[model samples]
Target: MTDSRATQADIAACVFDELKAIVANLPDVTGCAYERAPTDAQDLPCITMQTLDGAPVERRYLDGGRVANYRFALLLRKQDQEDQDRLDARALLERVASSLAEAHVELGASRAAWGMTLDTLPHRAEAGAGFADWRTELTLKYQTNR
Candidate 1:
């Protein structure tokens, strides 16, 4: 069994790649990019994932195999009219949620020892300045062999 903990960057990379793969099949999100941060240079729709927190939830063995609760945040950014952006963001987020319903597990080297699952109801936020901004978060739980 692996003895190392999965780092935040590792989780982010796995999620980013998985999200990008799913988004690629989305009809309306043809040009969107899966990014780690807002690239400001592009006004196109983009998605980002980040690790918020992690904690051991259960111990399965004496050697550090355990279930861990990892909170991950997904943010969607786009440029559009106030009302339109809100609706667009909602649609995009819904699509994303649907794609992730089965949950992404293992994710190459960032394997979740017991797979992954959505741990909480999604939370959403919206804002408008020159353009509208909308975001949502989903907490995911995965077993880790620390």
Candidate 2:
């Protein structure tokens, strides 16, 4: 029962599919893919996906089970943190909740993700994100079928 053949592409596709299923399966999302890091260890794999506008959603897989825990990261511009942008996180949370509500049963197959943890960091000005200072990371652990 080993799923070792699962590629970064496979995990990313699942992430994209579940994420897109949120907000009514909108087509606004684009550029979804996983990046293989030479430094990544064998047991833990990761992937990153970006929206058409360049915003990103990232996930990292831990051990397999009924609930999977994934870290969803997002990089937003400093300007995007304006008062208007402050609501962005809440909105996204609501979207995720809606996704969970609509697909709870379907999510029975999630076998991954029990809860989520989120954090944000401000990038240095020299990092090319002169205007994009915020890096938000979310750790989502779900209910897996162990």
Number of the top candidate by TM-score? 1
Model 2 agreement with the true structure over 110-130: per-residue lDDT tens digits: 444344444334232212221
Estimate candidate 2's alpha-carbon lDDT, on a 0 to 1 scale. Answer: 0.36
* Positional deviation of residue 83's Cα in model 2 after best superposition, in angstroms: 10
| Tens digits of lDDT, candidate 1, 27-127 | 66534444354546355466666566545454565876555554566666666666765676777866685576555545454346354454443334554
Stretches off by above 4 angstroms in model 2 are: 4-11, 18-68, 77-112, 121-133
Model 1 residue 127 lDDT score: 44
Report the lDDT of model 1 for residue 10.
61
Error of 2 at 29 (Å): 9.6
